[model samples]
Target: MALVFRPDKKSIEKTLAALKSYGNLVAPDARFNYDAKDGLRKEVCFRDEDFLSLLSSIDDEYVVDSILEMLKGKALVPPDAFYSKDAFDKLVALTKEKWYYPWTSFTKAMRRLFYMLASIKQPRIVVGMGIFYGYTLAWSAGPSCGKDKLYNAERVYGVDINTEAIEGARKNFAILEGSDHVELIAEDGRLVAQRLEGPVVFLHLDADGEKIGKKLYLELLKILYPKLAKGAWVLAHDVTDPGFQKQGVFTEYLNYVRDPKYFSESILFDIDQCGLELSIK
Candidate 1:
């Protein structure tokens, strides 16, 4: 249930030949990359362009469209689904206007992917773990709880370990157009998830742990595994391919999602070095 994006092949061609070609690329026997975070955190080689080199060698919109096509093929979204350009622009601009934090790691493609998943899935309850400034929360919650909401959401909760960051994110979310359903909680992600009763429609993970960092994803997933409703979507940020990932952090996490015993299917959006993984329950 995993996918791969190849630079030589241009896009993820989902044909039989393409899948066969990507076999070696995604083989489990591949060596792990410990410094996978280095390339992601480094600056642009060229001065004036995107500091993160958001689109280093590929077209941004094209990558998004290709991923959407893959999702459509999997029947996760409509045949002709497309996230609105104006809506996405407004969401980004508004968040930038009121943002209190100095950093948000999500690049443009990653942000769009989160928004697309939310809008398409139309999840009723969206939970974000390790939400720093609610930037990730806003992207996923935009379609249902923000100023540019396409539909209303019942509840959207953001859990963060940093009390001061949560306070800043609270102020940022306070300015959303129709974000009454959104709440920022200053608590550990696992604890907040443990408190959830049931039927959490959507979950976003981007937390950093003291020892494991992103590996806490597996623990959070196990906690909410029973509460997730049918067709629920779980997104883990930074679940990139082997070379662009930290060692030992996501091995068990990815295995859980790829297992049919848990998620029905999982796809890795490797458009960015800092990738996103989507799993359906």
Candidate 2:
């Protein structure tokens, strides 16, 4: 497809520079083509715009790449950057109430990362599918900030394979001292496909590999498409390009989702080694 934005003499260089930034996008080698001839070269990356058009288009990939590029060359900050003293106090209070955060790593790293990202976007509801004792991130973000918020909807509502994890998440939520609106549930995220609702934001921490990720990804789209308000995003974890040392499930799903006709955009991130921040249009 022709890029949405055409290049002129004044903008050709700028457009080329933007394409160069996506040099690391992973795909079948044949997906992109490059040639050098007569002291001239051309590189075709993913189907994107003439760099100038990207500045104006709302393509999901465009937004994701822009955000990732903005994040690059920048150091991550502590949770304090996003959480206020009161919010922190509430989180700690809830944790203490329920004997939560027994693990220092969750408090120090996971929760901190969640809050920092949340502070930037501040979605009303951040849902984590198939949560296994990992609600601290959502709790630390505080309640009443969003229209809908839940942790481990499947586990909370009594879904199978999540009983153990749900028990732990419940204890963690208890520590928050009855900030009960976080809406812990125990229903399968797959079931979400038929239950259309309002604009919802989600975080899929559910561990899935190639086939599983693909299944979950499609199921999630079925459930969330009609429900999502314009501009909603999904943050999926564990996606990476580890030099293709082995058959990686996360890598496969990342590739599948980046298809422009399906999921429009993605932002590669190095959170805990590797991850992709996705924005579905």
Candidate 3:
């Protein structure tokens, strides 16, 4: 459950060696310093290109390990450790495959985080607001396919505006060998919300950014808010970035969730630059 990296010299050396072997990259130098109040301060500087190249070549496990090694420090532990090893391993494999989307896609950490949330929530319905090549859809629904069936959902719905993206998502879902639980719909978020029945326990809001994305998300929430179960969880992507925060892109939506009348708790996970807002209703 220890999510913080807090790497020692040995751990850092091991990670660097792994990166070199996996990506043919090398760490130029490392600085280790200490402050009276903060204790050990460790910094490792490497080429950004090299790191990205390494990420491109390696598998999800290696990527996750490297991320943990690099970001070692005092941090909130992820809930993934609570799940069975088999379930976690399945999630890792599911995320390893390539999922193409026109814009930026979800990272290994983000996918893993989704799996953790799904395992914990075990919702009867899993809804993804933006399908986009079905990567998030697969991540949202994959855990439910486990032997123990971590998610007891009868259906998983993926809604997207782009017809081409929906087509691509269908192919992606097919590649995933999705069962009867999967449902891919090309429609507006409001319509998707209208069609949904029963309490939605897990909701993933990963639509595009800016005015369009903001409007779609707001519309969906307006319709679906009453349908959320008491302990339902919502994951809103791209809301944590400082740039978007300054622009007030999704501030209205976030403010609504932050209000005690709607949600019981909300937390921001600052992973990579892709900020995720986790709210419990």
Candidate 4:
């Protein structure tokens, strides 16, 4: 495939440098970071009070739309597939109402993209690694669950290392109707991926490794590669979540997925402050 939306390393580098130079995305005063009390991995990350407000801001939606078009252009998305905004919005509302985030940089566009992935792919098995509070997993499997479910799915699993977070996720998912198909487990992500049954169609990677958080994305992909379906899509989050500050972890990841030897195609989208790398196998 001739990818029109491949990773833009230079632009990402620039954005990272600017962010580091200016710093502190949560406030105008530049007072916090990923390590702050309510920063990156806290019980609650700083974000818009509600998802409706976040989705309402569509000024940069063209960025996500361009990516959707790219997926369609490259035939990654089915020609007959479509996702309803009303459905997606409802999913967002339900998630915001029922779920809690330990920490995330998830943006409106990113959530929409993940939800759309489910609507289009209609995967039988969906797996999420390092799903902090299950929201990421919920988004990836949105169309398969909930009252507005777009399709029926066989199984959806979310793996996290934090037992407490997984406990919270279980309770949250239990409250949401039609989410019985979704399972939350607290274990090593790599171990769970290796033990998975077969042919996972949609994989969401947000697992933080021993060293750099997102560096583990590559390892997860490598392990899951053989188990991936023919047209599987791997969504790696935080590909540029201050990656420039982490010494080329994401760069190596970008290179691996972009290379035709491993993946048929790869594209990097930085719609939100964070980046999501989409790869097809």
TM-score of each: 0.78, 0.53, 0.67, 0.76
> Can you tell me which runs of candidate 2 are displaced by over 4 Å?
1-110, 136-161, 207-215, 241-245, 262-264, 274-276
- Ordering by TM-score: 1, 4, 3, 2
- The local distance difference test score of model 1 is 0.78
What is the lDDT, from 0 to 100, of the residue 20 in candidate 2? 57
Lowest summed lDDT window (length 10), candidate 3: 70-79
lDDT of each: 0.78, 0.46, 0.68, 0.76
State which candidate has the highest TM-score: 1
Model 1 C-alpha lDDT per residue in residues 1-281, reported as the tens digit of each score: 89975344234233435545555333333323434583463333322134335572346667777788988997878897777767887888887776777787787788887887787888889999999878888888888855456888899989999999899888988887788889889998889888887799899988888777778889999999899999899999887634425255687898989999888889887666567888999
RMSD of each: 11.1, 14.7, 12.6, 12.2
Query: What number of clashing residue pairs does each candidate have, in the order they appear?
Result: 1, 16, 4, 0
Best prediction by lDDT: 1
Better candidate by lDDT, 1 or 4 = 1
Q: Model 1 compared with the native: what TM-score? A: 0.78
List model 2 lDDT by residue over 70-116, tens digit each: 54434232223333435644554555565643342232333444554
> What is the per-residue lDDT of model 3 for residues 1-281, given as tens digits with 9 covering 90 to 100?
86876768788677766755653234344333433246432443332333433453355455444444432332323424244447666655654554555654576667766766666566779889977777777667876774545546788888988789899887766656434678888887777788689689889987773457554666677789888888788888877554565467787888888998989877766554455787888
Model 1: weakest 10-residue lDDT segment is 43-52
